[model samples]
Target chain A: MFLTVLSILGACLLIAQTTVLARMPPWLGNPDLLFLLVLFVAVKVDTFRGIILVMIYGLMMDIFSGFVPGLYPAVYLGLFLTIRYASRHVIVDEPVHLPPLAAASYLFCSGAIFLYMTIFNPGTDILWSWRDLLLQMFILAILALPSFHVLGRIAARIASNRRRIFSTAKGGNRFIS
Target chain B: MRKRSKRTRPIRQFLVISTCIVLFGVLALSFMGRKELTLPHRLIFDILGTAQSGVTGIINYVLDIRNDYIDLIGVKKENARLREEIKRHQALTVDYREALATNVRLRKLLDFKEQIPQPTITARIIGRDPSEWFKTFSIDRSSSDGVGKGMPVVTVEGVVGQILDGGNHRAKVLQAIDPNSAIEVLIQDTRTQGIIKGTGDSYRLHYVLRNNEINPGDLLITSGLGGVFPKGLPVGRVSSVVSKRRGMFLDIEVEPMVDFSKLENVIVIMKSNQLTE
Candidate 1:
């Protein structure tokens, strides 16, 4: 119960991050927190549960943010599944890897929409200037680093505290083994 | 009786499960498939409209209450704004009436089409495109309201521009100042034709031959050579005439009678004057 609560708390914090980023001045750029949340979940939870949580959060983000809907959901699911596979085969517990993963996921989400537009809505005038893309990348890099670091630390602390409390309260017999 | 109850258990469960399944199916299908495809989607639309109206009403009520409080506190800024808006609207109504009266008078005065035969649609300018070079503006009317790409838009006084791009209930009009804008204009008095081309900030009557004998104050209306704009609709007045002694063509600057900077309302010209009842 505590772990579930903590996971939800993490999700809410992610939402708050998105809201703050959105409210910031336009020069700051729109940094997506949905990726950070998915990455955190992938590291903290197992594959199946991670995917489910990320899917729900992705759907919520898609509904909240203004754009073609489902664009976030499909991209987030893919990100989660990849992270899960990486966690299974690799050491994702390290702190340094999370930021890069978050940044890459953010880029994927941003690029996916443009890719979809280019293919489906052909001949419709769309501008792809280099200056805009660079600005977006810089903003995403700045946002993803701090978010991943803080959220990763918070998730780790909560996980440890839950383990300690559960061990003490249940005499070490209540953990699902 | 015991055997009958045992047999009924699975059937009852099946009935309940089937009902739940159908409900979920309806909801999921409506949520996903119905939005982009066959379903009328009127429920979503109605809900949205109701929400918008609700918001507008709340805003109006709150603003009214706030203004009352502000008046009590000796801040009468809103009153000044209201008075300003009132004056502006008064000017607009007067101009509208005057233009309509002129159209009536002109139709009678001239032996041309006695009736204003073409149908018209009045749409509000809802948004401005961010691209400066495109010089595009969007209006509320769309294909559903008999509006299409290439339809000409104008104020009662003169031409505004042509609808360059369009969607279901939204469209972008390429303003007269756009580099790509072109129209066939005729001198209303002599009926001398010239190609009206945009010169960045305003349009100029181009390709007017040296011998056309054009002068300032010539009313250049749409020539109706292209089916897009109806002929005889006032475009602009010839502001300047450059008489080149040896040049092949003359440069005539037209002052667009419709002030694009202060465009408040516009009417879409639907078809030729002869076609409508």
Candidate 2:
């Protein structure tokens, strides 16, 4: 389990490096590996580890990015907690429509970004246009989906195989012991 | 215990979705009107910011070369064309000299207030911040050039933003187009007094009296009310006027004279003879 989480963190660091270095050469769009990790934990991980990972991820982000000290970590971790709590009690249908889920995720991300900026910059006069944010969110999600699909498949394979390994252990208790 | 079947999950699903949606909205709203972004948040923003500036530099470089740079075969032709244009402009300057001299003398006779004497340094705007929300920028000049905080910066066109911070050889300017920037302005014709501000898109004339005799197309100039700015510098032109009988204050929109976003080169005005401390 520790190795798995470490691997995920390693991948995220790689993504962050790419974001800073090769990133959309002249394009301002930097991919959010943080968001990807949050979504992965919220959906794939269960139990206390999921919640712990949220805080861990948020802290890592705070340490790495130049956002306000506590804002993003608190907000993102809060999002993770909300997602985790919901997943505990609710059943997400498999073969679910990806768009709605993507939209929901996009909304969550926007809210987090907005909250962080608004809270930290009180006196700064900024026109918070919901229309602009919504438009940008949808567009970003659409772009993210192509990449998300490939990652999602890899993720699902890993998760399913992990489940298989655990269940086999359950059936062969005497032999294993 | 056997796990609960999926059949009973949707009711629970509705409740969860509704709760999550509500929680997100509330969290988002909680962030509104926050006073200061914590240091960590600012750091993340800066990293992203640096990356953004890097991108802007690349884009501007490419755009500049595309617009002006040409293949070897075409370079000479372009250069010659620019030289001829410059020569024509020089000839026109000679023709305008007499009238220009007259305008200057008349302005002196009218007793245009003397520009306060202070030491000054000039710099060029090198990079603009990625997020318009911050309304900040990085310039090429810095401490090595004697730039420092609280120094009022201006362009050949008009007052830009002040120097907020600086590095060894580079400085950051808070552009006048930034929503956070506020300047005192006077209308050219009416001499109407009001504060000029930016709304991230354009400059606005705010705090005008409801009954002020203002109209569209009025030229707004710096009143020098703030000790930071020199008098009579062009600020912007009044773009719109809002009048409602019961309205507590007049809503006036002014378009800034300078295109802050497209700012490439700028002049730094120093109070005459003042040196960087």
Q: In angstroms, give how far residue A81 of model 1 lies from its true place.
A: 28
lDDT of each: 0.67, 0.66
How far residue B267's Cα lies from its native spot in candidate 1, in Å, is 0.5
Give lDDT: candidate 1, residue B146: 75
Classified by CAPRI criteria, candidate 2 counts as incorrect
User: Which candidate's TM-score is highest?
Assistant: 2
- The DockQ for candidate 1, computed on C-alphas, is 0.01
The count of residue-pair clashes in candidate 1 stands at: 0
Candidate 2 has what TM-score?
A: 0.51
* Cα misplacement distance, residue A144 of candidate 1 (Å): 21
Query: Mind giving the per-residue lDDT tens digits that candidate 2 earns over B6-57?
Result: 6668889998999999999987797688888867689999999999999999
DockQ of each candidate relative to the true complex: 0.01, 0.09
Q: Which runs of model 2 end up more than 4 angstroms from their true locations? A: A1-106, A109-122, A147-177, B1-127, B167-170, B268-277
